[model samples]
Target: MKQLFYFGLAQAKACIFPIIIFLTLAVTKIIDIPFLHRYDLILLVCIITQMLMLALKLETMDELKVIGVFHLIGLALEIYKVHMGSWSYPEEAFTKFLGVPLYSGFMYASVASYMCQAWRRLDLKLVKWPPTWIVMFLSAAIYFNFYTHHFILDFRWLLKLLTIILFYHTFVYFTVRKRTYAKPLSLSFILIGFFIWVAENIATFLGAWSYPNQQRQWEIVHFGKVSSWLLLVIVSFLIVAMLKHLKQTKGNLH
Candidate 1:
């Protein structure tokens, strides 16, 4: 039974790369197909099912507690942001469970699990504290400046900013040790992320994925695009680096 579970896990992991490639091709219109939304929904369902299987096999009860807490925190932040108009979701895509969509909770839980995985892979002790601090600072600036629609009032913005800072600090506190065995920050990942962000923003502007509250001056919202580029670069690099580290570590163990 244990072997079967692991075998399934391996198969699922193998599928991820192809799934990403397929999605990317479809999104870019290189595939020239309809039913994009249906495919997206299928992907989401698959991801949720995969996470459930992982929960049953990989995570402990205590880890589940942490995941639950992070999910709640992320959901709250998303709700607050959406209510303030930072980013609006399509009503068709979400279920309003607590005046917020069920998808928000799912996103939160997924992010928490992902971050935990990253935390386990990198050893932060080798990296200087400055870069980590700067990353947190950038996270704050990005959250407050670009995502400000989540807080229309200055006071509310400040509160949200504080919450973001607290979350960043908490995440860092838990994940810092992994930073020690840092690998070279991959430029390829950063470039790919930047291009993806740019493409998404362009699609958004073209009404492919709407950002209802993004305001333009002179019919151009370059600032948002730039910030998106930055966010994606940082996020993608971190995620890829961690995944690579995990792969290498596992190979070493084998």
Candidate 2:
């Protein structure tokens, strides 16, 4: 029970950036900022928050690099997804481009932030991690499938199954206070994906962005999106894991 409390506390700490972003989304939905567009203001808030965290030593430079990579990757994906008519930034903003608000990328960056923070706060390490080639192949497939599925047949479920098989023996070891606990890496992906799905619903409800169906009226996001989030979480985890592996092993990206 005590360990569980500590684990939850660490999780909350890790989620600081995501929580702040959600709050900003909710507040900006109602609050009028006459001086600036809402999306621009959101972009500004995200920038300021990141700078403050850096100055306060709340986030390490390495983590910032990770967040930066995720930001660009996310923004690129967003640009394409919007172009493909997946979803949209319905409101106006000077910072908007290719139909995506600049701040929208931070939504993905926030997930990377949580992963980075949790890795440190929980003293996380991987066990029985897959080989570098297999991991990289899977990561590439999972990421590309996000875009390919829009044009071709959706291979997400098959990819998910492959992910499970590859990482079935893998585990993440994390410390909760003085005690240590281990969880299957695959299960961790599903749980984080679930929570991100919850956050997505909150973001949509707060008017961060609207799905096609929600554009007319607010509605619960489809459960199918959970699969997308699952793959996304896996991608995010793999990126961070590879970085950690490189740093820790000084070469192997396993």
Candidate 2 residue-wise lDDT, 135-215, digit = tens: 989999999998998779989999999999999999999998778889899999999999999999999999888889998
| Candidate number achieving the greatest TM-score relative to the actual structure | 2
Q: Tell me how far the alpha carbon of residue 197 in candidate 1 is from the true structure, in angstroms, after superposition.
A: 3.9
Output candidate 1 Cα RMSD.
10.9
Q: lDDT values of the candidates?
A: 0.44, 0.92
* Residues forming the 10-long window of minimal summed lDDT in candidate 2: 245-254
TM-score of model 2 (CA atoms): 0.97
Cα lDDT for residue 146, model 2?
Answer: 83
> Candidate 1 on 1-254: residue-level lDDT in tens?
65445534543453342344335435544443354443355346535654664666554454455557645655676677666665554434334543455544544354444434434432222232224454555445544553554345433335334434533422222222222212333332334345546555554454332355553311334554544444534443343334444566688999
**Where in model 1 is the C-alpha error above 4 Å?**
1-63, 97-99, 121-209, 213-254
Best by lDDT: 2
